[model samples]
Target: MPNLIAATYAPLQSNGTLQLNGIEYYTKYLTHNRIKGVFVNGSTGDFVSLSIQERKELLTAWHQNKPNGFQIINHVGHTSLPLAQELAAHSIGKADAISALAPYYYPITNNNLLIQYCKSIAEAAPELPFYYYHIPVLSKIQIDIVAFMKRAKTEIPNFAGLKFTENNLMGFTHCLHNSTDNQNIMFGVDEMFLPSLGSGAHSWVGSTYNQIAPLYQAIANSFTVGQHQKAASLQQKAIRFVEILVAYGSFLGVAKGLLDYLGLPLGPSRFPHTNLTTNVYSKIMRTLENEGIAPYLGNLP
Candidate 1:
């Protein structure tokens, strides 16, 4: 049951500071959704906008409220190593695992700096399993798969896995071939679940699981438990759902709407993200209705 089904939480905004509801709401959200773990302050959670203290609060809150048997993966990536270290240290005893990304909003050279950067953060939380989050789209930094594995072994001791979000299937094959001691490779995209799992992605963490966790779990079970056909059928349905949701607007807006529709109090995107158009909203709603997932919409406001 340790196989991870993690949710990326959007920190609530309050009076210019990120405010996460205390244990009550956090625990309620996880329990009701049957989530296996939490991935706070990750890309889907809008990690870029949160301050270090706010991120720490979210991590601590999850550690305190998460149901027994549930785990946490603290995402401590930041533009500065110092801040990343602070979050990592704060999560030392609080989270089961910790992950960090290549520093973004700046240019970087080779896999050397990226490896060194992740190594420094992992060192801060030596006892926790560390995962390297590779989201090339946002970070603008790509690590050579082979180079990363070679350096990780020498420099990062507690390195446990990686979140490879790149959609290149060929690239994924190459990375798995480069693993040492069953190093876990988690796929980050929602729509690629089947192919990713088929290609040997042992674990995953993503945003849509907040609302569509059951569907994701079904897809995973189908493949792992001798229902390949069922998994493929469900995978097609899930991908179609993801495509329609994203088509309605920016990924953040659509995801927030889904969270709201599910009666989760995730609120709107903090800022720098725009609202969806009326036509797109109507179209999305129609798609939901057609797909029979409207019952989960509950009492959306």
Candidate 2:
């Protein structure tokens, strides 16, 4: 129950300016729904796209104005150790805890490499709890989860838990069951919430929460209170919206489009990630219009 529901804040723009709504909308979303946390600079937050200074600014604003009682989990993953360390240090006093993925765009060896990398980071900010991020699809280095957990417990005591973003929920569940039950486990996939929770997931980080936080809160609490049917129904709604978005284009573009529709100045995604094409744009607009997702856009801020 420690700020269980979290929104992944994505800040990307062709222009130099960071859209303040990327910050404000989530803060306002949290306030409106009485949700508890805001996760900044994660995969959905587009952490790798922003400069260190931009990441710092977003974190600063969240620290300053996040609704009272809301926890902030800052993702500080970077290819450079120095930069990652500096960002981890910066996030220490600003947020409740922090996270970092296995260094991306590089081939890595065994769990030892990951253990050493995470330990070095854990050593840098001894004051804050550092959650290890596991997104093999993005990082390309799947640290054997069981092996990583074993080493973390013995080597880095400051190593708190994991933000598992892999598509393999069953495998992740096996890892969870095989490891220490006390270690906190947060699910990364938005669509797999119910199964993950049923499998004993404790926390979650999702991009869709940025848009439909109240609905997620309802689903999460519904599960907690033994309302599995209701939780599934709510989660179904979330999945439906996500399907529509993906059918239009990439998840990132759809998320950005949602933000844009909300009146936020969050511009288009970076190159190699083009905006929706004409036909796709029309389909997205039509889907949004049909779904009444516009009302939720207004609810964001």
lDDT of each residue in 1-301, candidate 2, tens digit only: 3244555545555563676555665577556655668778877767777889989988998887776777888888789988888898898779888888888777666887888888887777887878898888888885678778877888987777888888897778877776665577778888887778788777787777666666666777899999999889877777877888877567776766666655555677764444754466666667766875534333544
Supply the TM-score for candidate 2: 0.85
Per-candidate Cα lDDT values, in order, are 0.74, 0.74
- Model 1 lDDT-worst window of ten: 292-301
With candidate 1 superimposed using the best TM-score fit, by how many Å does residue 255's alpha carbon deviate from the native?
A: 1.1
Model 2: worst 10 consecutive residues (lDDT sum): 292-301
RMSD (Å) per prediction: 3.1, 3.1
Where is model 1 more than 4 Å wrong at Cα? Answer: 13-17, 224-229, 275-283, 292-301
Reference-based lDDT, residue 99, model 1: 90
Residue 43 error, candidate 1, Å? 0.8
Q: Give the TM-score of candidate 1.
A: 0.87
- Give the local distance difference test score of model 2: 0.74
**What lDDT does model 1 reach?**
0.74
